[model samples]
Target: MNITKNTTGIESVILTSPDPQAAAAFNEAAFGLGARLQVRAGDAPTSGFRGFTLSLVVPGPSTVDSFFESALAAGATTVKPAKKSFWGYGGVLQAPDGTLWKIATSSKKDSGAATRTVDDFVVLLGVEDVKATKQFYIERGLTVAKSFGSKYVEFAAPAESVKLALYGRRAAAKDAGVAPEGTGSHRVVFGGGLGTFTDPDGFEWETLA
Candidate 1:
């Protein structure tokens, strides 16, 4: 799979699947994100969301409502309906491949103004030890954006690139209201320019060509 981020920091991940064209169309229509899919030369495993989720942060309550409705119209299953939260307005959905997605808006204003597009995109992973995972990414050349002891950590991605974060596994599961049962192949493929490496939590990441 190939993942690219737009100048707006919105990422479009192109992947090889049983039917690339259809897959791409589905993703684009479903999430309003770019995707390029192709039939694979080898067997493809089923996809699932076990240890991680893709987060899309928008500007306001209306945007979240619109996006959530759009996703549902495009065949996404609702994991949670959008609602007010201590953090902000947000909801969850499950793609056809079982990838979990969270759409949210922060309560805090951006630069004292609201953002109209995706404010940030991140691959949030649940880890056994947030502090150790933060250290691991730090040692691998990733800069830190913020960290709260071992409870959570966010990494600085290249401008307009998809960001990464780590959180306590149990906490993450609790936040998602799901049981933490990640195992086997993660189904989702990650490719950027960071080279191929598996995090301590067994989440695989690959560098872009």
Candidate 2:
């Protein structure tokens, strides 16, 4: 049997925050992510860049603006303001709890009325070596959907599951407009069918069952 046949890329993501209640409230108010995003009480000491950023891919520039504006209104500080680029429109923001969020879209203009709807949620983990981490996830049954040499890798995930990707630490931080230096816990964990195996960068994962 092909052991990788039954692999589920990423079933769930749990954020370990120092203030669970506040984190929960802020997330709900900001994005209404529902059960798609999870949070729990954690005091694991961490500082500076947490080595990851969550991305929200929306329908158009309008939708991107909707999320970007709301996140700012809900206590998120601007890392990069929403703006149109050659690829599309997007921006980065840091939540009150220090989570970096990237809201973006590939369309330069709105096709319809603007609404706060999200098209995709991506978890971008920053590692020291993209090639090594990509190989590691591949060995753990994650099928690579898109790859850009050693600079980045995007994994295929089940529908409704959060998408996973890997990027270099400095590049990921630069994309989020932050310093690359960091230490201590990543303060996050993933639950999936791949079982419990921490990535090379020290991000933890637990068995879904």
Judge candidate 1 at residue 55 and give its lDDT.
84
**For model 1, how does the per-residue alpha-carbon lDDT over 1-209 read when each residue is reduced to its tens digit?**
11323222113333445555555565667665533121222234643337777788888877777777777877788888888888988888876556678889885333344334777777788889888887887666676777778788877666556778788888877667677765565555566655678878776666555
Ten-residue stretch with the least lDDT total in model 2? 1-10
Score candidate 2 by lDDT.
0.87
lDDT of 2 by residue, 35-123 (tens): 77889999999999999999989898888888877788889999998998988998999999899999999999889988878888899
Candidate 1 Cα RMSD after full superposition onto the native fold (Å): 5.8
RMSD of each: 5.8, 3.1
Runs in model 1 deviating more than 4 A are: 1-22, 35-49, 108-116
Best model per TM-score: 2
lDDT of 2 at 67: 83
Provide TM-scores for the models.
Answer: 0.80, 0.94
